[model samples]
Target: MAKEKPGDDKSPIAGTQSLDRALEMLITIAASPQPGMTLAACSAVLQHSKATTHRVLRTLVARDFLSYDDDLQVYSLGVANLRLGSEYLRRIDLRRVALPAMRELVAETRDTAHLATISGSDVIYIEVVDSPEPVRIFSRVGDAVPAFATAVGKAILAWTSADTLDERLPETLVARTANTITSRSLLIDNLALARERGFAVDNMENREGIRGCAAPIFDHNDTVIGAVSIAGPAAKVPEQNDSALGKSVVATAQAISALLGASPDAATALPR
Candidate 1:
């Protein structure tokens, strides 16, 4: 006889009714949009009794994993997701490797530079370097932006695992500026470019007057650990003007990856 796997659902619905109901409810809510599904809608989708669904959602909301909008009667993912992601970074060597390089990039361009990582449906800032120019990048450490909206965010999103991308980038984009790539096809094109050229650019995508560029950084396993970017005003980024700034961002990213024990064989030039 074949050995039974632990926690396997092969023995029929004899003992895990509550767990099954809860998981089904969670999955149903995750599959919905507009912050979340209405409690009635969730019960309908999961085919569970209203009482079971309510009990599960209430417990999850209490734990901070889900939010219930009584006004709209919808349920959605909550702050617990952010907290869990923050905890994941707490165990990693994010600062030891990314900070020094960010500072170096800031010095080179006299513009703000930052290191960011993909965390669920957002891009979380892990490190930041301020330019001496008084004007600076809008993001700070621990700040997050939609993955489809920012230059470094898009770079990391492009390199992320497909499942992760699916969970993160919405089927439709959230428009932050008139130039933002709200179309999924256009964002995919950008992703293709980032993968092909080893860097990414945002020409007023996140903010009306902002422009930025970024590059991916890999770990010892060749996994893209994060991305780094330099951001400034639009008037500064056109042509070779800010292109020079982009080169430095790419260089800083590569250097940090090296510190993380990565040995990239592709282009690896540090901007002068």
Candidate 2:
């Protein structure tokens, strides 16, 4: 008779021990510091006999879920894993992934929170979480606003490449309000400041009576994908309180980025 597998009896569902072991092995291999693991190392880490470990590895290799390096005598993730990851990333809905964090931001700041993506020289509001306060900034989803005049746009633009900035920004930046930065040179300087501080501020630049703070969201590749912002009436979101609000916005943006597979270290890294 064949020997019983580990956790066979303890498993909640019957006949799942093999599947569980296979999944655990995959997780262990993926989390390893080294690029790959030898059969012996994998066996030791799994705390299973070499015979049992080899069987599992062979099955995974056959399914193209893992690859064996003949010369290195090691096993690593294979093309199948990449295919699954690609499918997962492709199906991800950015608006849905960012909604919870946006809600939390609105709760924390008592201001309207927005999730926006860049489209040419404009920022499109894809999602919004309204503040609970009686008096708050009102914004609608699908609203497109000038990129240079808003905190969300500045947050994303700060991390974008120089060529992209030049291509997107027009030769003449039309001012939306008295406080809007119309000069390209000055706006570039402001973006540098935003990159340094990890957040951006709109001090009545986008709208006369509104002020906002925002931070950029990154993806798995460490690219700036979007931005999260909290906006409110100037009285509530005062210029003096920008630092405090900025920290909140940055934290929220980082939280959203984490869901999108961006490491905290990568999120905090300086713009290239």
Candidate 3:
């Protein structure tokens, strides 16, 4: 006889039990169309005894993670589940929809560009377009620095709720450079300015000797998706383009917005 594998018989059973116990019944009910499924259906999907499945689902209903409508006696997704899933889907969509626009920005700027979306206290870099310049700045996909510290980050934060802003950064600061804003009050004033101007400039706040300019990207829903930024050496970028660099950066972001079905306001907000 072959040697018995360690816990082989019991391991799979344990895993199945844990999953069955965890599936919220009310949620399952809410997810079903026509308001409910028969007891037989639940057993078929979970491959468990009807009694065990019913027990788990009833518990979920009691906790408000799910609900049972007696008259309809059918299940559908709960509002809470919808809300949670919606936020996730929104960001995923943001990434897909912004790609075309960021590509266009890169084409026009001839410098590196990025599409950034806010994540918690930081602005996450979702995509980047590399600089054609021989000596260039290279930022990979999915790299995020603090939003309070970068041009693109500030552009997105400027439109975010103030309460969310306070939670991410205090009035004091996390200094990344000697030029970093150490004063909370000053940063707050700058945020207000960004709100008024519809754009933000990093001015070497995050990295010394590097300058960055950014403008926010908006969706058809009027929600801010992220920002597009042009960053390079301060000496080279500003001197080479005069004010045209800033103008073009802003224009690129606006063009991205138009692609995403933004309002006509995008025309005026981001200009060449």
Candidate 4:
């Protein structure tokens, strides 16, 4: 008989396996579309014994990472996690540094400007500077749009690594509008074009009456951290002036990136 291997056996890692399982349970709870998840539900999804799952969950509740309601018999993310997330966003430093530049961009173009970061398969707008024009476009600060269908999202995607893109983007793109790129090949081509031009454009791809242009913001490490965009009605964002608008947005994004300690050479190379 062959010697039994430790890998084949049920031996857990010394100090981290429990942490991993606890984190997975938290993720499962967070991912549920419903308001909360039951202990039995989490156990079923985790394929762990109910007793073990309960013990871990109680521990998480004790530490305030999750909240357990005795009356409802449900688990939800707790205030402690909210505190952690809020602190993480605070540390990003990008949002605080980009606001003035974004305001300037909006003032110059008389079009809405957005600062967004990629979250999973979507672009989450963290800041919005509204245009004063009566007919200008508007976007809420916390809203999300499909990453492949928006200029800001596409600008970041153009600078994303292949491995990260593979993990974040679905194989088949979802169509948001008639002009949205629905094929992987076409999206690849589109990103290539954006990379070459140093900015991205969305011509009624995300919505029928809107047009937008954006450029990626880089960090000190030369990593694409976020993007800045200018958006307006299709009539105002005419095809003839797209290049000029793209150049302006890229310049504004570069200015913001520089404030965040981005490399001077890298920032200057981005169509400024």
Candidate 5:
């Protein structure tokens, strides 16, 4: 007979359904496009009764994971989330390792440089080095962008395992802009190109007037831990120079990977 899992009912310590539900609610709230969510709104979308959802929200608010505006009756992520994010970054050493290369990339390209990692189905920015130029893309450290619509996201996804890709990608990709890829087949083709070229391009797909090129960053074990990108106004990032910029991003990523102790051979052999 097969061995029982640790969390089975017969185990010494059983799983907690309420904890699972609370985490699910937290994820839903975190992913909301809007700044805050009302109790009714969260309950409606989560399919949970008002009383149950409210109880979880109250607990989260008390713990500083969520913030509540009593007057507005709205809730949003709180300072505790920021602390957690900081802790995560510190633990991974990604920010510390990527910042120098990111700054150099910005100086070389005169464009905004970003470092991001996958979180659930989204790409979360952990570090950003703004361009010295007057007009540049303004993105925050904790901002989350759709993985299927950004160059950094595509570069990371191209090297992700097939099973993980299926889990991360949605059935229908969200259309962030007119140029966004809505079909999975087309996305696969794009990934193939990224894999072959060792870089990816957004081409103003995530936002109008913005274009980005990116390459993946690997860890000591050759795992793709994140990506680094160069972003700027579409007019400034022309298709004619995309190849050159792609090479620059790929080289920067490789340098960072080396700092993280990844073998050059292992990094180059990353699977698509």
Candidate 6:
């Protein structure tokens, strides 16, 4: 006899085999490189008979989770999937989803990790994970800083639309510190670099003797919703270590984005 495969519904669970197969089918179709999957292609990928695959596909189509195109003989995700995704995104708490990763980032870097969102021309700190070291950066949860002078703000700004950027960015950027970029042209150049490197840095621009590295966080819709940042004294977060810390911040931001249902392609997409 042929050996039964995993998720074949022969185990202790009474009727999960069909459900497992259906979910797998949905994932396979969603991940397909083409716009949709032919019945034969679906069956081949699932390693199941055409009849069984057709039945599962029919059930999904009936439930509106998948759509079948007669002309193309293909199956693709339907409106129901979009509704489900929208509902899931509506209920997600950004700070709560990001706290664990922020904590982990602080542990690794020994610097304060902050979760912040854009509020007009300011960046508001919604959540913070403090460093464990004796002398570390301190930040209040509700503190707001100028979006033009901070790493987190620059990170988010790098991915914002041109129209939004024009609205958020002022005609004249006031210097918060001597290191802050006062020229609009220079700041724009800095944002461009941040977008290219996938992260941003503040070399004592936001506050004297403080430095930060940050990366933008994208949502399921590939929107720049917020940013994750690590900040500490300039002595500890030196320029040489910016690359390493930037990588950690980017990873943590990506993890939070995954939890928010962002697709793999979301990370690489630029502003619309």
Best by TM-score: 6
Candidate 5 runs further than 4 Å off: 1-92, 270-272
Q: Residue 272, candidate 4: how far off, in angstroms? A: 21
Q: Could you estimate the TM-score for every candidate?
A: 0.61, 0.88, 0.60, 0.64, 0.66, 0.89
Candidate order by lDDT, highest to lowest? 6, 2, 5, 4, 1, 3
CA lDDT, every prediction?
0.77, 0.90, 0.71, 0.88, 0.88, 0.92
TM-score of 4: 0.64
lDDT per residue for candidate 4 within 74-132, as digits (tens), equals: 99998988898767645767888899898889889999999999999899999999999
Candidate 4, residue 219: how far the Cα is off, in Å: 1.0
lDDT of 5: 0.88
Model 3 Cα lDDT, one tens digit per residue, 50-142: 888767766666655565667755444445666765665566566676667667766776677878988877888888878777876778898
Error of model 1, residue 219, in angstroms: 1.0
Clashing pairs in 6: none
lDDT of 2 by residue, 44-112 (tens): 989999998999999999999988999989999988999998998998889999998888888778899
RMSD (CA, Å), candidate 5 to true, equals 18.7
Shift in Å, residue 205, candidate 2: 0.7
After superposition on all C-alphas, the RMSD of every candidate to the true structure, in Å, is 17.5, 6.2, 13.8, 18.1, 18.7, 5.1
